[model samples]
Target: MSLIRKATILRPILYLLVVCSCYGDGGGRILVFPEDGSHWINMKVILQELHARGHDLTVLRSVESWYVPQNSPLYTSVTVNPAPSSEEEDLGPDFFSDLMQRSLALRKMFPLRRFLEQQKDTMAMLLTFHGGALRVISAILDDAVLVNQLRDSRFDLMLTDPAFSAGVLLAQYLHLPMVYNVRWINAGEAHMTIAPTPPSYVPMYNSQLSDRMDILQRTENFLRYVTIYVQERLVIVPIYADLLRRHFPPGADLVSMQRSADMWLMRVDFVLEFPRPTMPNVVYVGGFQCRPAGPLPDELEAFMQSSGEHGVVVMSLGTLVSALPKEVTEAVAKAFALLPQKVVWRFLGERPAFLGNNTLLMDWLPQNDLLGHPKTRAFVAHGGTNGLYEAVYHGVPVLGLPLIFDQFDNVLRLQVRGASRVLEAGTLTTENFLEAIEDVLSNPSYRDSMQKLSRLHRDTPLAPLDSATFWIEYVIRHGGASHLRTNAYDLPWYSYYSLDVVVLLLTPCVALLWVFIFVCSRLCCSRLRRKAKQD
Candidate 1:
């Protein structure tokens, strides 16, 4: 071959190498489902971030979570299921809701044997999950990789979010590592579960601490947690069994199936928590806030700009709890009318009549973008954990009107942390709403306090995102997730539940009873002997 021909071949190969170098990198069999709206956003943010860092993102999305009531206790109300009504009754969403509500209420009251016997039809429908759970399971099973997202603690993992049991079973059968995350406030936060209102002010909230009842009121609160633990097992075990029957015919021991978890990543930071003991498995990464803002839409940007007198107060009850019922809307609108500042509320549906000229209601708003604005003063919200992070990230104060599970807890935590005030839903009238809003707005101290907490929230040695990236990369390189797991798994449920005490107590009682019987028999024998001698 001539030198001229060799040079020509090398030139083409060099050009190809340059093109390959310019176009960077390789990728995961990641399967993600955004069944919940905010959850979708959450995954999107992570997906984008990961993609930027060279990841193959596979997101299974549906309109749920932050936008709708799909993931909560109320989602099934929109579905349709039928019972064999006189061999001809057809069931609609309304019928499903009514039937579901009755059965759920009954499950609370009935013991296992009674519930199983009476709830045959309801259980059949619930297990079938014609609404959507089965479909999600099928989708997950079909995914290239199984990523069992432990976003909620349903049956300790994704094992039992009611109908989603099938999804959990599918993930397990595929040998997927359950990725645990705290999509809400840290459960380990010091007994913040106690009622928010002072015992004396219980009348205001129209409630009483369930634990405050007399002996007959039932010592259930203490036992309730343990009962729930058992109940979770009962629910998941059956579903697991059912799925195994239909699928994993080879079978798996229950203990081994339960034991399999690759890693647990906490979506919370210790700064957000009220100081309490936490296990090693519980990685404290509360700083994993939503990805920061980009450009805002033109309309949203304009809506946020106003004079000092017209302040922006963002009110959203989150996606699942979006149905603000007419009364709540009117109450909120009336409260906004009372406030001197203009309110930009991300309200769903038609605007309320009580909404004043100063108030602007829209179906959607750029949440973090609005908060990041300098004029934005305070946030009135349902106290979702993600929302709390947004407010903190922006150095804004908040008035929390919590309506459901853990919302009240988050509100109280904010109150205790001096970051916000809790506005009880029962007393959430126009006056009370304005009062709480005014308290957060007028009080420079509250703003300063929140800003202080915000500073603390961000005062890490490394940027939160950087820290998260480092740990994730380290895990991938080392491939040793066992280092992150807690010793809680090693201990038996008896030790965790302290069933040892019951055994100890029963042992002493048995010994005492035996001693009493022995002494009594000896005395009777002696008496008989004396009587015979006398004769």
Candidate 2:
């Protein structure tokens, strides 16, 4: 072999050796307790990256999980049979669609009435969901053999999605250092639990109000903020009471356990989320799952080319929601028909009678690939965090049909930024939907705003995924990130708020004021007596 050829052949081998030496013989052992469905999608991305980096990952999944599979090439799967009834299984496929329909119905009522009813319904749903989750964890804990095996495994850390408290509780029980892949905790947005969220500016989840709030809006925000705590205390905390009492220390509670995480990999960016106070332990890795688009399939590419001058519009309501209500879908179909742009929709339900020939309906489409297509004009979405971030990443303007949960708030953020238009599914009509579509298509500003946002989101020191991986590896290298965490979680509520300190500081001043008042009154009485004597 020639000298140049031998050197070239040796180059890659030397590089591989260098990389392997940097990571050591074998990577850190990581245990992942993930939430099911869409949350799993996000977790899976991180797991894949971690696996690629030479980490040994073990994923704990429920037998009835819809998304977290029992078999995977990335990680060793540990499937736990919680009970005869599983939370994931109990929430049948139609759960989200049904919830969306109920939410739409509530939207038609008086605003106050709607808020009250919605709160009631939401609380009931949360209780049921969390209750089922507790059961699953309880089952796992009860399995002494399984618990012992997990303990003996000597896992470096527990990485979890704290959407449900199961992983939090389990991590605490196993005494593992935890890193949370979290956006929402059990009560509400993760920030509400760990940061100082002043109601004056930081809007509450589901308020659908922006950071800039007037007095009335601030009042609403404050009330909603109080309501979240109330729900957490009364509704959510009790669901985990038994598990905590049995498995944890006397003072340990769900919120405190959640806050005790070593690091929070917040799946949000300030470009997409309203700016708020954050903790040292919290790291924003928003759009970690997003990447530059790859080539589309031959058939899909042909469709894109066929759009010609008009371009194509892509729509997807996320994974959980396969379709909207019949009336809403029909109206949407009619609107898509009116648009000159070709439509590609990710629809799973029966075909809408009004669906035009211009529209292509598929059970699934490569969402990221389609959004990145050169001929892609605009996106119609349900305002999921993943999808919204993907849209921002791709710089595609949106027409939002927000359904439930954080969808309303997610779309509102984009609308506030002038990157998207929002519509209510309850009041959707063919004319309004088409008008909204036309407005987005015709207006140059929406695309401009979104493209600007894309530039900002992309203009980061490191890719969000790489940042997340580094932090995860950082946690592993150090055993835990305790130094980054705050001692605030250790303080009692009164001490945390400084209520006791306020009382102590005020007590001396209050006593001094009383003494002064008494002396002044006595002097005045003496003067009055002397005046009477003189008279």
Predicted model with the maximum TM-score: 2
Model 2 per-residue lDDT tens digits across residues 1-535: 9999999899878866864565674689999999987899899999999999989999999887899988899999999987776454368887888898898898799978987997898797888778778878998999999999999999999999998889898888988899999999875899988898899999888889999999999998898899888999999998888777887789886777888888899999999899999999899999999988899989889989999999999999998887898999999999899888999999988899988989999898989888888899999999999999999999999999999889999999999999999999999999999999999999999999999999999998678997797788788878898898888868888999999999999999999999999999999999999999999
Per-residue lDDT of candidate 1, residues 269-378 (tens digit)? 65565444444444445546544566777766666665465567777767545446566679888888877777888877656888787787777777877777776889
Give lDDT per model, in order: 0.53, 0.90
Clashing pairs in 2: none
* Candidate 1: residue 14 Cα off by (Å): 33
Best model per lDDT: 2
Give model 2's TM-score versus the native structure: 0.93
Which lDDT value does model 2 have at 151?
97
Model 2 root mean square deviation, Cα atoms: 4.5
Cα-based TM-score, every candidate? 0.65, 0.93
